[model samples]
Target chain A: MSDAERLFESLARAIIDADETAAVQLSETILAKGFDSAKAIERGISVGMEKVGDFFEKSEYFIPDLLDCAAVAERATAILRKGLAKEPVSRGKIVMGTIFGDTHDIGKNIVALFMEAAGYKVLDLGKDVSARRFIDAAVQWKADVLAISTLMTTTRGNIQNVIEQLRLDGKRESFLILIGGRAVTREFAQTIGADGYAENAAETIRLLDKF
Target chain B: MTDISPKERLDRALLGKPTDRAPVVCPGGMMNAAIVDVMNKTGHTLPEAHHDADKMSDLAFDVYENTGFENFGIPFCMTVEAEALGSAVDFGSLECEPKIQKEIFPSVHDAVYLPIGAIEKTLRAGSVIQAIHMLSAKHLDVPVIGSLTGPISAAASLIDPMTFLKQLRREKETSHKVIDYVVNQLISYAKLMADNGAAVISIADPTATGEILGPKFFDEYAVCYLNKITDAIHEIGVPVIIHICGDVRMVKPQLQKLHGDVLSVDAFVELKQLKTELGEMRTMGNLSTYLLEFGKADEIFNQAKHLTTKGIDVLAPACGLSTSTPSENIAAFTTAVKEG
Candidate 1:
């Protein structure tokens, strides 16, 4: 294989192996070799993360494995970010958070990881996020999609309140609102006026890809 | 059948012995049914009930009497174990369940191993034990199930959950030590409950599911520690109920290895199929809480009938009831199993 091809392959392997040290070393090597960092990320880390997502979809990779992959990809991305241009291209901007009154975020974290892996810029607002914060973050980030996750049935109504707040703020039309979590269902998503509902992280990426 | 009491009915059903019909119950902790509708009707509410034994007993009785559930389950939320273990907890208002505000340790390596019985000395544990005693004494015909936050979840609650899950792979030694310590504490707490008149000890470990831990870790940690607690509970003379939240398709083999008298799972699992797979196992639950929260009474009743006809040994909510869930829907659920 050509040298650049070999380097990109190594970067992807580092991510798939969830070897943060190896991924950071490979990204450093890429930068030292004056390779295109954004191309390296799009070609290498993203591909490995896509594989991780697929493994998760097949139940071959559980939460810990997915989390490791996300951690490796994050570290490698941090190294590569320095080499990219001032304005590197992204797939889209997505704002994500666990809805108000629900502190569970593992599902949301995985969703954010998959979205970022798919090349979207994700602003994670963390857990127990309020409707106002969600709307403000989406508007401030100029997001293409607003993703809300919740785990408890008690907190399910808060997702509706988020959508309602967006409408009241006159910003409902600006971004697509997506909802998912253990408690959320496709039928409930429809009932709550959510634009889309995903069963898992992979489905969320596929939905975002379509739009 | 004529002399059957709710406690005897539940005990028999849990032991896989025959009864007039399935005994519907809400195993507190995560599956609590002290919903707003019930509290409103009875005028006994949470956030206040959580800390006072008398109030807690009254509220649990209110849930049992109003919702047609057969038992009194106490300490309404899962945060009790976490709180007693040194985690910062936010005891939420009436409409919201308490949640861990901050884990005491950021990772298992950083965890401070408290003395085994430290949890028993906590105010929340005291309240729960006192409440269980009061309920079991006052409502002699009803069983009082003491719900415990299982070992894996209790360990996760002490450390940041994300960090803890990752550390289960990265820091196996410290993870085991911390979890073993937590299990010992849980045993003490369970013993305290059993001594104070708790008829059944239910363990709900929401974090230890196959989907989260995979088969390998689920077997290594979840099953191992759960069996440790279950054996202790059994030695103390109360039947143990083990509730592992989420789909168990990945961990069916490991799940079969659990020693609890009754195995409770989430709504998505097929309890009938599970019973067939694990011969002679007593399966307790599989009702969708979402339906109880959102569906019409007839729909809830029909689903309850479906589960009943499937021959599940014990009838209960698939998972935690939403605090906002309408009483009529929960009534429909319990009514279906009771009437059948």
Candidate 2:
């Protein structure tokens, strides 16, 4: 194999193994060796995390390893992204956050990482975000999707509030709404009028790909 | 009229005994100073100088005095085992309770080994052993139950749960090795607790149940490890109670066959369906924690009565009550068990 191909392959493995330091160092090494920055991110970091996500869905990888790999991918992506900033990017934009009154963010954070790695411009609003804030951001960013998450059964109603306000404000059709988290089921998503539901981070990517 | 001591009432319920009514079982939810004050008013005292130990016993006895519960559980928190394992924990005040810092284990391989002599020396371990000792000395009249977290759950708290779950996926063999080692440690602890004076050993493994993993992963990892621990504890002749949080309907059949004397369900599970599915194994719990925390006394009573009608062998909280849950809410649950 060519040296660039080998470098990209090694970078991908390093990200999957959750070696953030190695992933970042490898990205620079690849760039120093004259590989394209965007190609390294797309072929190395993103592809590596996608494989990690698949392993996680298949029960071959657990949460800790997935989190570690995501961290590694994020570090490597940050380094590669600086080089790509000089050029205009064509990735779709997304607004993501956990709904109001819910402090849980582990699941939401994983979904956000997957969305970001999948080449979406993620606008993370963090936890305990209100409905109005979510809609306002979606409108401001012209996001393709507004993904809402809530881990508590008590606060899952907030997802519906966001959907209702968006519809009332006449922006419902402009962006697709996806709802997910531990307490949310596919049935609950349909009941709340969300466009889709993802059981886990890997499923979120599949849903976004279809979108 | 029939004769029934608190211990005898609990024993009868476990044996499917017919009694005056369904016996109330406190599955380690009776903690906090508020509960202890009521128990002290009803003639209970701290078994030892340790505040948590004294508080646990007093809370258990208080449930009996105020609500007429049939069973008294000591060492009301699950963190004792994790603390013993050397995990740093912050015991939140009466309002906050205790919690392990989320960032305790930043990496999957950061010395995730269980400490040597962890079963014998930790403060909470000593507390549990001593609590049992004191309960046997003073409260032989009532069944004194002890609680411990299953290996997987304790390990999750010590390390990061997300990391541990990922390790299970990436390195199944290594994960099993860790689980097996931890289970051995737990079995030793369980036997020691039983020998010290605990009549029933309640195993709380909320993280290893159905909510986190589907049946495929559970059967492969959780079921076997739990069976080994339960089997060892049962060999010493102590009854084992398996408690799993979340909706465990899919795992009820597996749970029934795991050699535990009773299976405790969280409120999310439908007790009627569980009863029909398991057929003869004793089942307890299904009172919503939120209802107990936020709802009125009447709601707690009605929910407890409703669970009893579904054929629950013992009445208890679906999971540990939040520290902020009012003492009145627990009283309402115990009252329903007494009247029903």
Overall lDDT per candidate, in order of appearance: 0.89, 0.74
Q: Can you give the lDDT of residue B146 in candidate 2? A: 74
lDDT of 2 by residue, A1-211 (tens): 8887777888899988887667888898876776788888888988898998998787676555677688788888877766674753747788999998775676788888888887888999987799999999999988999999987665788899999999899989999999899779999999989999999999998898899
Off by over 4 Å in 2: A1-105, A120-211, B17-20, B29-52, B63-68, B102-116
* TM-score of predicted chain A against the true chain A, for each candidate: 0.93, 0.93
TM-score, cand. 1 vs. native: 0.95
Per-residue lDDT of candidate 1, residues A1-211 (tens digit): 7787788888888888888888988999999999988888888888888888888889888888888888889888888889987657788999999988899998898889888877899999999999999999998889999999998777789999999999999989999999999878999999989999998888898899898
Q: Which candidate is the best by lDDT?
A: 1
Q: What DockQ results do all the predictions give, each relative to the true complex?
A: 0.63, 0.22
Docking class for model 2 is incorrect
Residue B96, candidate 2: C-alpha displacement in angstroms: 1.8
